[model samples]
Structure formats: C-alpha cells, structure tokens
Target: MSELVIKDLQVSVDTEDGPKEILKGVTLTIASGETHAIMGPNGSGKSTLAYSIAGHPKYTITGGSVTLDGEDVLSMSVDERARAGLFLAMQYPVEVPGVSVANFLRTAKTAIDGEAPKLRTWVKDVNGALDRLNLDSTFSQRSVNEGFSGGEKKRHEIAQLELLDPKVAILDETDSGLDIDALKVVSEGVNRFRGQEGKGVLLITHYTRILRYIEPDRVHVFVDGRVAESGGPELADELEANGYDRFLKAQV
Candidate 1:
C-alpha cells in the first residue's frame, strides 16, 4: 500500500516582484484505495497544490515536504516521482501534435514499468481502455489531443490514467470541460482504481457533479490557499446547495 503525505506545505509561484505564496501551511494525507476531494473557488491555490505535488518546475516549494510511501518526493525529479508511483492528470492536457496515442502510451508504459508491454497485449489493453471511455479505436492512430474536442481531451487523460495505473493519481479538474456522459465515463475510470490493497486519489474540482458519481471518502474545502473545512461526502452536497459563500466569508 502507498500513502501521500503533505506536511506543512507552503507553495509559491515566481513573479517579477518575488515569490508569491499560494498554499499556506497546508497538510493532508491520502492512503491507498482512498479518494479525497479538494474543492475551492478560483485562485484558492487548489491547482497550485496539485502542481506542487507533481513536482512542476514552475512552482517553488517554499516550505514543507511531500512524501510518497515514506520516500521524499520533493527531492526526486519529475520523472523519478512518476516512477516512484505518482501521477497527475492536468486540468488542461497538452497536445502532442505529432505523437500517436499508441506510441505515447507504449512509451509511458515502458517508462513506468521499465519494460515494454508486448505488442499484441498492449494493443488489446489500450483497446479495452478506449472502449471503456467510448473512444473510437481510430483515436489511437491520431496524434494525442490534436483536433480533439474538449470532452475528448478529458477522456484522453483518463485513457492515459488507465494505461499508467500509478499508485496515486492526482486529477486536477478532471471534471472540467466534460459533458454529463463524458463526466460519468471519466468518473468510472477513476472508480476502477479503488482496491483493497490501495491506490490514492486526489480529485480537485470546482463543481460537485463528479462527486455524485465518484463519492469521495473525504471532502476538503479550500479557502484562501488553506483548507477551511474538512468532512465526508455530505460536504459536497452542502457546497452545491450553499456555494462557496461561507467559505469566502470565513477567509476574511
């Protein structure tokens, strides 16, 4: 089993003026097989936290530490952290103009497992995952996310998730740009990761729609770069009902 621990984490982004703090002494934990949702308004640093955990070079970890299954993740390079069992599905998945999906998946799969998946087996696995996402097999022949619709891009991210199968998956706004059907497809893909042995999920979103399908084990309300409230699934319902007003007021 694996665990992701964020202890006293403070993050800052570099600006011409200086380092601007985003996350303020935030700490959280996610154990294997558990799902945690991070909800917040825009500019609340929700995305910053996700990028920091994934070791994005643009963000500076001004303070604190991030550890994965007892290993110091902050000290590891981005590729090393992924090999160490961490995955981040970005809010805006990039377009690799010339890379075919099959080729990209194979390369990522090999990098993660340190062995190439057999050609026949890999094709079958990729096909099965595409079917689950309702993506056409023809997509595998096309360049990654090039000319893909918003919903298609999101589904493509889920496709990568199915292929990578990391120990922990941080989905930064996976619910964004997805229609109802696409949202359910993405949610189901995330659901498949739950297991008795363990796989952790950090779902960052602004809406409660995806939570209705995935049902996080815990919900955290982030306000002004820190967690303002933490609770169970019902917290999502409350956020949907009352919105982030109380959270914004509390931040003051």
Candidate 2:
C-alpha cells in the first residue's frame, strides 16, 4: 500500500524580522485510503504544513523529511510533486486568464500520466466530471477560475480532483466559502475520490461541518504548529461541542 510519511518536519518562512519558524516538528503519516482531517485554529501552521509538503518556494525546510512511498517529497520540485501523484486544492485558487479550464485540466492530466489522453475519451471524461459537479459545459471553455464566484472556483477544484485522480489529495480550507449545497457537492467529489483504492486524503479545515459529509478515518487537532491530539471521528464532535479553547489553554 502507498503511504505518505512526514517525520519531525520543521518549516520556516521569511518575514521582515528574518526567518521565523512556522511548523514546529510537525509529524504525521497517511496511509493509502485513509482520510485524515486536520482541524486547527488560524495561524496554527496548517497551511504551512500543506504548502511545505507541496514544495512552495516561500516555505523553507529547516529540518525533517517527507516521503511518499519511500520517495523523498522534500527534494522534488512543485511540478515534480504533482507528477508524483500529489494534488493540493488551494484555499485561494489563482486565475489563469488565457488558459481555458478544459486545457488546464488536460495539460495537468497529460503531465501526470506522461502521455496525452485520447481526445475523444478525454472530452467525455471532462464533461462527465463537470456534470457531476453541476458545472455547465460552457465552464470548460472559460479561462481557469477567471471571474468565477467563490463556489464555482471550489467546484472547479473538485472537478480537477476527480479528473486528475491523484494518489494523495491535500485540500486547504475547501469548505471556507461554500454553502450547504456546494459543500455537499464538494464533499461528494471528495468521497468519490476516497472510494478509489489506495488513495489518501489530507483535509484541512477550521469548522467541523464538512466532517458531517466526509467521514475521516482520523481526526488530528493541530495547535501551535503541532498535532496536539488525534483520535477517531468522534473527536470532531468533541471539538464541535467544545472548542479549541481547552486545547489552547492546555498548550499555554
């Protein structure tokens, strides 16, 4: 089975004050087919952990190792990480003014697969994925995320997730701006991806609402750049009933 392992990972970012550490010895492991929910308050280094693993140039790896099925993920470039079957659905998806959504997805697929998908089959698959997300065919012809409403952009991310079929998907605040209906749609897309064999998911969010739909195998409570606690799905309920206050107080 495939696995993503992070061992004592430490990351830092540049600021006017010089390099300040963000992720403090964060470590976690995700096995194939296991959905891990990372719940944390803002500024707790959740996004830093996500971007660090994805090879964002802004984050510096001060220490630690990240491996995917024994391959060193920290050493790979951003595009190289994608080709290695890692997908990150960003919280703020940037727009590419000239590239149509269809072309963007196709290009990503071709890169990951190492060959172009047959045109006829590719077209059907794209349309089908879009339809499943309730996106219109005209969506495929539009530039990537250009002028899209918040919900539309998030839906487009799921559409890419379905079509690309990555080994491990790291979603950063996917439910941030989604309504109930859009949340269900996005959750359904994630569930569909989880249904695939040996696929792992790292879902990050502040609210527990998405947990109602995508049942995580493990729930990790992140506090102060580290995983303060971890348990089964019930932990999310506990968090909802109480809040991060207890955890934060303990940390202090």
Candidate 3:
C-alpha cells in the first residue's frame, strides 16, 4: 500500500555566491515490493537525490515534491519522515561513541514505532533480528559502529534497517566498502526485507556487483542530475560491460 512518488524533484546546495543545483528535474515512482537501482558516475547527483528525499538540511529543494502514500514528504521534518516509514542508509554511517548498539537499536525502534517496546518482547525481537543477519549478540554491547570495520559498519546499517523495517528504504552505496562476505550478508538482509507487504527499496550504487546478489526490478541511469535512461536488469549488464562511458557520452 505504501508508495513513493518523486515528481520533478530539483535540489541545490547552499554556497556563498548562490545556490548550486545538483539534481535537475527528476521524476520517479516506486511502489511496494519493488527494488529500483540508480547508477551514475560520481558528481551525478545520485547521493544528492537520496539526501533531498530524506530531508537532509544541507540539501535545499528548489522545485517539485515528494509524496509518500499520498502525504507530502517534503513538508515533513526528518524525524517525522522516518516515523512515516522512510529510512535512509547512508554510505558513510557515523560513529556514536559511548552509545551501545543495544541502546541505539532500542531508541530507533521506539522512535520509529512511536512507542517503547516492552522489555521482554523487545529483547526477543532484537535478538531474533540480529540472528537473522548473522550478527553476534555481543556486538549489541559494543559501541555503535565506533571501531567496526567497513563491512561491520555496513552490517550495522543493515541491522538498523531490519529493526526499523521502514516502508521505504534508500540505500546509498551500501556496497561500496564491503568485502565479499559482508556484501553477501548485507544482501541477504536486504533480500529478507523485500518480498513483503508495503516494502520498497531504492538502491544507489555505481557498481553492478551488488546487483548480482540483489536483483533490481528496474535500473535507471542518472546523468547530469537527471535520469538518462531506464530499463530492466540488462541495463546493469550493459553498464558492467561498457562502464558509464556510453551513458556519459549520451548526456553531453
């Protein structure tokens, strides 16, 4: 039932001189049970698109609107959007020193659901979700991503996604710094999240290697802050074969 509609969205970042547009007019729609991949070269605004939709303060929306399930998302605050079932897994997850993973998970779960979970029930739920992702229970006692490796950091992000279970998940380069084993674990967690009611994913990455594990229903090539082309999984194959050179050429 949940759907994300991005209509002619444009974004810019603030500068002393003036605003510098990062995302051109862009439109896309994603419904439940669908996975969409957006691929482009660096500085193509792929990450900008994600940040704008999530209402990051640094990114300014100059044009268009983003609606989730018929509600205007651009007008809502960041926490409000998350509570409304929107989740963004950043490429570089920050470290929360002195905050245990267990505490962080509980807070996120409570915040997303708008209510604190009972201790007994919450414990089982948290443990079960961690087990599904092959994460050690001891990790819960450690500081949140403080000293974790690249793969561990990514896995921690995935763990948050699983625990939050937002209706729409925007993953920005989650596979960028992960190893093979970590990638598989992260992909498996994503797979488990998919194929369910009111679930959708927007995977933003430049490499097709992640697609090998998590198949996308559609792939869109982003160039010059707009979608240049969109097609099935074969588009990913083409990108793998020829890189983004052809697409970059077409954008010029």
Tell me the whole-model lDDT of each prediction, alpha carbons only.
Answer: 0.91, 0.95, 0.92
What's the TM for model 1? Answer: 0.98
lDDT of 2 by residue, 16-68 (tens): 99999998998899998999999999999999999999999999999999999
Candidate with more favorable, higher TM-score: 2 or 3:
2
Instruction: Itemize residue pairs with steric clashes in candidate 2.
Output: none
* TM value for model 3: 0.97
TM-score of 2: 0.99
lDDT of 2: 0.95
Model 2 lDDT, residue 49, Cα:
92
Q: List the candidate numbers ranked by lDDT, top first.
A: 2, 3, 1
Q: Give TM-scores for every candidate, taking all chains together and pairing residue i with residue i.
A: 0.98, 0.99, 0.97
Candidate 3 local lDDT, 105-158, one digit each (tens): 999888888899899998887888778767889989999889988888888888
**Residue 169 in model 3: shift from native, Å?**
0.5
- The window of 10 residues in a row where model 2 has the poorest summed lDDT is 1-10
